[model samples]
Target: MQDGTTVRDVMHRAFLGVSESDTLGDAAELMLAEGADCLVVVRGGEPVGCLSPRDALGAILDGADPGETTVDEVMAPPAPTVPADSRIAAAEERLVAEGSSRLVVTRDGEAVGILTERDVLAAGTTHPSAGAEHAVRGSAADVGAAEEAAVDAESADAPTAEATQSICEVCGTLTAELSPSNGQMLCPDCQEV
Candidate 1:
C-alpha cells in the first residue's frame, strides 16, 4: 500500500480460520502446520471468535482433552472489527482503544483479512509523520478524555479493570502496560527479546 493506503491495503490476507465446533486437536494441528499463534474463529462464514494459543494451552492445562474439547470452549470473542475501506489511522486508534493488538477485517459483512498494530507501525515508519498526519477517526480521537471519564465512571459504571490490565502473551506476566512485539504482547523484560 502507498502512504494513503486503506485498511484493506495492508491487512493480512491469510485468514487461518477454524470453526467453534472444531476439535482442539484439529485446531492445534492446523495451527502447528501453519505456524500460527492464533486462528480466526468463524461460523457460517461469519467471524465469531478467535482461537488463540493461550486458549488451547489453558484448556489443556485444565485437563480438557484436546480431541474431545471443542474450540468453542476455549476461543475468545472476536476482536473489534473495522471496515476494509476505513482509514489506517482509524484502525490504529481502534486497536489501542480496544486494548488489543489485532483486529478482524470485514468487507461487505464478510470476514476478510486480519489487521495488527505492527501493520500500522510498519506503514507509519515508511513515512515519518504519517502517524501525526493522520488523525484518529470519529470519537476515537477522544480516547484521553474518555479514559479520564471512565475513572469517575468506574464506580458507578461497568468495571474497566479487565480492560486496563493485560497479560503478556509470552511469559504470562500480568500488567497494565504492554506493547506488541513479534505478534506477542510483551512486558518490559520480554520486549528486550
Candidate 2:
C-alpha cells in the first residue's frame, strides 16, 4: 500500500444513507438498488447508525417483519469510523483490532465515505513488492487456482472485473471477496452467515 496514504485516498466516495424511521424492507430495497452493502442511518442529516443486510436477515430470522421493522430497531451502531485524513495503516489496524471489514470515513465530525479491505488490497497490489508476501504463502499454481475460483464466482452482472464498486448482495458492502452464488453476490462473511 502507498506510504502515508490516508482514508480519504481509498474510501468509496459515493455512499448511501437512510433515515432511522425507514423500514428494514426499505433499507434492503435501497441497498439492492444502489448496489451498496451498508447504509448509514441518519437523522437531521447526521449519521446515527448503520444498516447491513445481515442485520436485516438476523431480524427476519428472529421473526421481525421487514416491512414494519424500523432501521432504529435493526441497525448496528454507526460503523467503526476514522477521520478522512487518518493514515491507511491506522485504519487497517483498527479494522483488524475491531474485526470489521469496513469503516465509516468522517471529516469534521460528519460522515463522508467508507474505507474497506478491498481498497487496501487494491493499494497493496499497486506497490512494487505486492507479490512478495503472497509468494511466501503459496506456489504460483496455488495462486492461479485461487484467482480462477474467484473469477468463476464473480457475478456475470458485474460491469467489469476492475470495478471494485460492486456491493455484496448478502452483506451490503463493497468488498473484494464477493462471489456470485445462486444469483446473489455474497461476501465471505455473508457466505458463512
Best by TM-score: 1
Return the clash pairs for model 2, or none.
37-172, 37-173, 38-172
Q: Residue 175 CA error for candidate 1 (Å)?
A: 11
Model 2, 131-175: lDDT tens digits are 222211133344345444444444343435453333466544545
Put down candidate 1 lDDT per residue, 1-193, tens digits, no spaces. Answer: 3546899888998889998999998999999999887799998768899988778888999999999999999998987899999888788777767867788999876789998866765554221231222222123234334334444445344454444544466754434678888887787757866
- To one decimal, what is the Cα RMSD in angstroms of model 2 from the true structure? 10.0
Model 1 weakest lDDT span, ten residues long: 125-134
In order, what lDDT does every prediction score?
0.73, 0.71
Clashing pairs in 1: none
Backbone N/Cα/C clashes per model: 0, 3
Per-candidate RMSD vs. true structure?
10.1, 10.0
- lDDT for model 2 comes to 0.71
Cα error of candidate 2 at position 18, Å: 0.7
